[model samples]
Target chain A: MVQLDDLDRAILKLLKQDARLTISELAERLNRPESTIHFRIKKLIEKGVIDRYTIILGEPLKPKSVVAVYIETEIPVIEDFLEKYINHITKTLSMLPNVLAVARSGRNGIIALIGGETEEQIEKFVDDTIRTLPSLRKVEVFPFTNIVKGEDVIGFLVDV
Target chain B: MVQLDDLDRAILKLLKQDARLTISELAERLNRPESTIHFRIKKLIEKGVIDRYTIILGEPLKPKSVVAVYIETEIPVIEDFLEKYINHITKTLSMLPNVLAVARSGRNGIIALIGGETEEQIEKFVDDTIRTLPSLRKVEVFPFTNIVKGEDVIGFLVDV
Candidate 1:
């Protein structure tokens, strides 16, 4: 198990909010000595408790409309063909810029997050790109309206 | 539309990868002058193109299993209760540490992302916490087997 004390968690919580905090600022905010704060951060990084830093794009780069698509492909009799087909579809979807995220649900199920400038555009993409694929047994599109929690996730997951 | 040229896109892409890069390093890597890179970043922030700086926690802090739950609530006879009930449920779910993301899918539907130590734990959470809620017409849980795209999203959204 990952053992984290109160100090470690406090530092992580602050960093999670703003990664640009310097050692001095962190020390001041957390009421810890500068040396101790610096050492703790170094240890956290070394232990892989703090992953590599990255940036989240803002609204200017985010899509205006988003949809979560759940797709289930028909299991071919060959069984071997099922695995290959699933891999092929997942790889193809992952390469698209509009597809923000994609993950396999089960044996033949795939869930994808797609974004666009407008609902019509998203619908068109789903029709042209997703529905056109062969061997699809089920496709359900859930339109995401108001994101009450994790509202910034769209900006975070969007590619530059 | 937000007008961004090649230089702007290049800088944004690099920053998205690593926001810790200094202006001089970014200019050197992108073959632009330091002054130009500095000005561009300043403008980007002013234009709200950069959004905000944040951190992604490492695997040590991440949950071992995650699932996306889709819920549709039954419309009540009162009609007025629908909105209030949905809001109540969403707020309640959002407050839980295990519930990572929550959004209103439609007028009577909700979508949430939940994480736990194992599949059984997640299942128990859904059954004990979510399934027991009143007015729920349907509940579907989709386990994330393997994320092919936007893999860092989990770490990025996880709270410290």
Candidate 2:
């Protein structure tokens, strides 16, 4: 586990909320010296604790509807073929703009977060693009009606 | 829909990768004047196309294991009670630090992203925290073995 003192955790929390904060601003907010704030941030970055700085696109760019799709591929006679097929599915889904995130679940299952302008549009995408794929056992779709926490994730992961 | 020109998208794409890029750097990369880059960025922010700036934590802070949990609550005789129960469940789940994201899947269902040190720990958390909740009809856990796209989301959403 990473050893993070209260000061380090405080800085991290502030940065997570707003990465654009200047050293001086952080110093003032955290009641620390500017030099100390600068040094700590530099050390954090050097230690790989601060991975990257990025922007989250707002509503103008975000999809109106989002869904989580779980896909389970049928186990074929050749085990090797299943591995290759799963890789292919993940890679193919990753390239699509609407497919916000993709991950392998267990051995034969895959999970994806998809976004679209409307529920019907996302459903159509699943039917035409996902369901049509060969050698699948089951595909379950979970629609997100209201996001209670981490709602900004859609904005964070949306494509330009 | 908000209208965005190619230059706006180009700038957004670059910023998404690295928000710390100076206006001059963006201008050099996009082959535009620094003043123009500055003006465009200002306009984008004013229009709310560019949301807030944020940081993604590195591996040291990210949970080693993540799982997507789908929870469905049993509908009660009173529809009013169902709404309150769903709200209570989502709010409770959202309060937990390990529950990275929570969203209402439907009237009676919820989907949450959970993280922990190991898969066994996460499963134990689910068993102790989630399954014990009253009026739950089903609780499904999908362990993420490999994340092919938007993997940084764990880093982005993980709490300090």
Candidate 3:
């Protein structure tokens, strides 16, 4: 297991807020030497902690409906099922093109985010996207009434 | 940004699979010494790379029809509404207790995963849990047809 100290905690909190922050900027925020921040980040990469640095794009508000999806399936519950089916589902979902992020839960369901220009457009988008899934038994799409938080990914990691 | 080598990528991929691995065990898999592995993890922690350790709990295959919800809502076109509503939506969705994950694609929509024991049970659960959101003006529910990728957290991150 990895152990984290106060500085580490602060640094992570900062990065969670802004991964694009440069080493000098991060060090300045944490009141540390730029060299120290750079070295620490390097070690973190070597240890497999920081996976990668990528941009999180904001979707076009062109769509008026924000949809929330819940899923359940009837698969033969077994390890072989997990090993074989996991890859297929992952590939297909990743191909959604409009999907923002897909995450796993403690239950046998997936949450998907998609966008469109209107209620009908969003509905059609949902219909077509769900149809692309092969083993899916049932899927529910609930368009969001509102999003209280977006783009901010650190909420789960810390108390704001 | 942290510069990564192949070894660093390997470490990240492995740990992303399972964060519960012991330092010594991680070293064996990475073909590195325990001390080196330990140091790398420490450095990663200090750099805010690995956020924290957490357990993903999936309910023991219960008897509910999984529902996927898509929410389309209105947001300020010029301003950032992702954080405002996303936070609120996440808070509400999380409060449902049955909700596993809530994800959004900016202002266009929010995708949420919810589980229950039966179709009716899931329906009631959604009605009781989500109907109260003040910002949500409309909603659409799609019972999962088949899970395409289910939850691909590791698959989304790892090369293997």
Best by DockQ: 2
Top-lDDT candidate index: 2
Candidate number of the best TM-score = 2
Which model, 1 or 2, shows the larger lDDT? 2
Docking class of 3: incorrect
Q: In model 1, how well does chain A match by TM-score? A: 0.97
Per-residue alpha-carbon lDDT of candidate 1 for residues B44-92, written as tens digits (9 for 90 to 100): 9888888887778889988999999999999899888999999999999
Q: DockQ (C-alpha) of model 3?
A: 0.05
Can you rank all candidates by DockQ, best first?
2, 1, 3
Give RMSD (Å) of candidate 3 vs. truth. Answer: 12.5
By TM-score, the better pick of 1 and 2 is 2
Q: In candidate 2, what are the lDDT values of residues A27-116, reduced to their tens digit?
A: 999999999999998889988899999999999999999999999999999999999999999999999999999999999999999999
Model 1: per-residue Cα lDDT over A22-109, one tens digit each: 9999999989999999999899988888887767788899999998999999988999999999999999999999999999998999
lDDT of 2 by residue, B1-160 (tens): 6899999999999999999999999999999999999999999999999999999999998899999999999999999999999999899999999999999997899999999999999999999999999889999999999999998999999988
Task: Give the clash count for each candidate.
Answer: 0, 0, 78
- The i-RMS of candidate 3 is 11.0
Q: Please identify which of the two predictions, 1 or 3, would achieve the higher TM-score against the true structure.
A: 1
- The lDDT, on a scale of 0 to 1, for candidate 3 is 0.55
Chain B, candidate 1: TM? 0.98
Residue A117 deviation, candidate 3, in Å?
21
lDDT of residue B131 for candidate 1: 98
